[model samples]
Target chain A: MIDWLISGDRPRSVALGAVLLGILFSLAFAPFLFPGVRALDTAATILIFIVLVASYDLLLGYSGIVSFAHTMFFGLGAYGVALASIHMGPGWDALIVGALAGALSATVLAYAIGLFSLRVRAIFFAMITLAVASAVAVLVSQLFQLTGGEDGLTYRIPRALTPANRVGELFGVRINGRILAYYLLFFSCTALFLLLLRIVNSPFGRVLQSIRENDFRSEAIGYRVVAYRTAATCLSAAMAALAGSLYAIWLRYVGPDTTLSFEIMIDVLLMVVIGGMGTMYGAVIGATIFVLAQNYLQNLMGAASDATSALPLIPDLINPDRWLLWLGVLFVLSVYFFPTGIVGRLRAGR
Target chain B: MTQTLLETTDLTVRFGGHVAVDHVTCAFRAGELTAIVGPNGAGKTTYFNLISGQIGASAGSVRLLGQDITRMGVARRCAMGLGRAFQLTNLFPALSVLENVRLVIQARRGKGFNLFSIAASHVEMTTAALAVLERVKLGALRDQKVSELSHGNQRKLEVAMLIALDPQVYMFDEPTAGMSVDEAPVVLDLIAELKHDSDRTILLVEHKMDVIAKLADRIIVLHNGALVADGPPAEVIASDVVQKVYMGREIADV
Candidate 1:
């Protein structure tokens, strides 16, 4: 059954499988088990990012493409949902239309970028994506009336998805629309992740892997490298846009800072690298750990700093204000120790 | 004329002021094994690159069975039945040996785009890929990564990939350059086997005289970016141009 889900590409490491299962179970029961607002938000965010990070993995890890314009696609999806809700009013149709429009636009933009710049060297493509992403960021900030500008757009979704719509009780936990929204994100992300798994295990995915290994030889072997790259780019962009739509629906808001930020792009890159490049499961582990650490690590640091306030230098060094510093340290240590990312390390150890 | 499999008309490539391949016109007919020989820095590989669409021709054209493919991309040319192996082994080093060959077969068959189909579920394709691997004597190591294979085995794997591609025109650049004597015969034997088909054309670029003498039906010698001699192996080997240039005696033409 597991083989069917992943199309027979095993996780290959017992520890890795356990971690993935743990994440799956926790996500599946987060609303019931965690029973708090912040925890639910974090869980929902992780679910959304699982799709976002995994889609990025398909591009960077599977196809050897380094694209910085991922946030542009994500923002497009958010804005798509935002604009649809504002113009068309709160409903499922608006959400669907907005998501589709965002995905379509993102795919088209990716194809255009891929066709124009993929012919150049990898570094040049990276530069082009960076430039394009920056331009989109600038545009989103300047397009005030249309996009709500820097402040971003906040609007309604279906009433059933909001915290106000109580849907009774389940196992001592009050069931509400927010819980429904969380489950919606959960199931959609799982299905999407499985689809990505199927793709990476398919013949099409192997061609991308081969291209990543040696593109010059892939061309000689009759696989059009650029065409496959463009196709993967388009697919990845659409997936990311879908993830963004989910995020906007959950947050009930879309802003440049929330969706189109460079930090989010960096986070996606970090998650992919920390998870392992080619292994899709790495995305799950990576996003879970990175998001958890980002949210909770500072709290732990703050407590530690308070405890060590009696000591002069220690409190200042490990201060909660420097959570980013600690995060950087963690990233460096992971890269140094794991080298191939956590999943790669575990698989190698196995 | 035995259905010319590939032809080049004044095909040339230049890097700034340097002409890497200069106005090289040639043709390969069916059922013939043609060897391209040259002194160091002669444009033998460059000419192969031009023919295989690795590098575009600065001037002139390349045609496969009378269809002009000069502007075609590498994959397009391969799809149109042009198969080439590199002088240095080029392969998916991180993939298993079987997977490397299977991808070629998948691409050639145009089924590499099946997003939902499990690659292993294609039992017939796997069998076919394994058969090609067996022919190249890599069947035993099918599960091993290409990077783990010895240089000679990688070269054999390169041939296996080409065979799987099933192109009418086969371009091999120094196929046995790094193989041991025992390993060399396997590749030579496979080339000999490929030559058995009357519809196939083989082009080899090598510096070894004995291998050229043994396998090549005809020999073409290049002297510093230009085709200097073309004839049967015995005739070209005995010619003054090959004797002075290829044998490395001082020659002014280069």
Candidate 2:
């Protein structure tokens, strides 16, 4: 099993690298190590985004299908778990059932969307997904009685995952609910990432790449192009939904802004681009870099702003509040110079 | 009499005010190499597209092995043994040459939907794909990316993919469209070798008279979306109608 996990040169290295990164991130989140660092919650958020971005890459990078509706599926998964926990009363079993429900719903919805929209041209298909996703986002926000409107829904996870439940201690660190939740996110994300790696390396994945390169030729060669594409859509959606379920459990809440917002969709797209499209490792690297930047870069910029408050430059330009502006500039520069993403550049070097 | 393998009746396609493939009727007999010769915009490709189900016909019915397949899709036609190579070389550019051919072999072996197994680990598929590469004389370059190959080699790779399909009816639309003078004969010879099989029916669209002369058992001349002449090459070459419409003074002089 270990050998299989790190089989191919590039893929093996990538998988092993992901494992190492996961461990390092987990260690950073541990209470005993880096006690002054208060970024465990942020670290957990980055792990969830790894799963989400990788899932998105499965569609956009591997299959060459540009879908703006990915966040809708992500939102569905989160809401699924949230509603299930609220209705069934919080428990570990309820969380499992909710995750399953979310994944299933996302799969069904993806199938329908893929069937109807995949028949159209690529650009038209993208537009249709965008329109459908926007509509669903509005619908989720307006359903006050069930979805909690704009206020969102809050529910308890299993007691073991709550902050109040302290499991024990390990390596001079207290293993409480927060620590347990971090580890849970770590293992699940790693497993899902490996599964995606397996899928993209499989024969089915090869056909998807062929279709991506030339759909007409793929069809001409006797592959059912639409069916393969639809299958890819469903698989990617289910993975994204699973990530969303885990995300909701981690946050202990689900809301339109946090779950189904267009910003989340853009963030995923940015991650894929910055990490590199078509390389699975891009998702892992992209999410890590983006999340870290989103969390720490703002603080770093704020410190700079405090020291340079008397500068004659435009106040808005140097304002720490405009961290996103600096991030956007970095994103554009990365795309321009490293268009293939960080993984792509690394592969090219070797 | 040779059994009819494919038949097209009153096939027509109109682009609004223009008729691309006018009322045309034709038949491809089993075990014959038939070449469709025409000038640019003569609808040679549009005709291939209509019969191959690449485009919806304005009016016509296509029958393969005596079964009507006019409404069938491009993929269904391919599954039913109608293989087509595009005028422009179409292939998975990023994939290795062997992988490209293996995909076709995998499609034929009915393993396209197998998601669990690694594609390269399929011994049978790999062996068959390698055999095809050797036949096309692309064995040494099998590991090279398709994009790395020259235009002529890419054309051969395209034909190799068609060969992997082992289709009963083969359609080649300008297979040597952009090949160098020396490279054109390589593809022409490949077509001739396939034509040697009495069970295979080959329909090719060619501009080079030398290739058509060497391979065509019969010649069908299309001018402005209509069949103007059809017969043995010698007879068609002698026909004033073909000479006037297509062969012109230069081909006649040759």
Task: Highest DockQ: give the candidate number.
Answer: 1
Candidate 1, residues A1-350, lDDT tens digits: the string is 87898899888999998988899999999988898999999999999999999999999999999999998998888899999999999999999999999999999999999999998899888899899999999998898989988999889999999999999999999999999999999999999999998898899999999989999999888888989999999999999999999999999999999899999999999999999999999899999999999899999999999999999999999999999999999999998898799999999999
Off by over 4 Å in 1: A305-317, B248-254
After superposition on all CA atoms, what RMSD does each candidate show versus the true structure?
2.5, 2.7
User: Model 2 misses residue A95 by how many Å?
Assistant: 1.4
In model 2, the runs with Cα more than 4 Å from the true position are A1-3, A6-37, A302-319
What TM-score goes with each of the models? 0.96, 0.93
Clashing pairs in 1: none
Q: How high is the CA lDDT of each candidate model?
A: 0.92, 0.87
How many Å off is the CA of A27 in candidate 2? Answer: 7.1
Tell me the interface RMSD of every candidate, in Å: 0.6, 1.4
lDDT of 2 by residue, A287-347 (tens): 8889889888888887877787788775457678899889999999999999888887776
> What does candidate 2's lDDT look like per residue over B122-188, in tens digits?
7888899999988878999989999999988999899899999999999998898888888777778
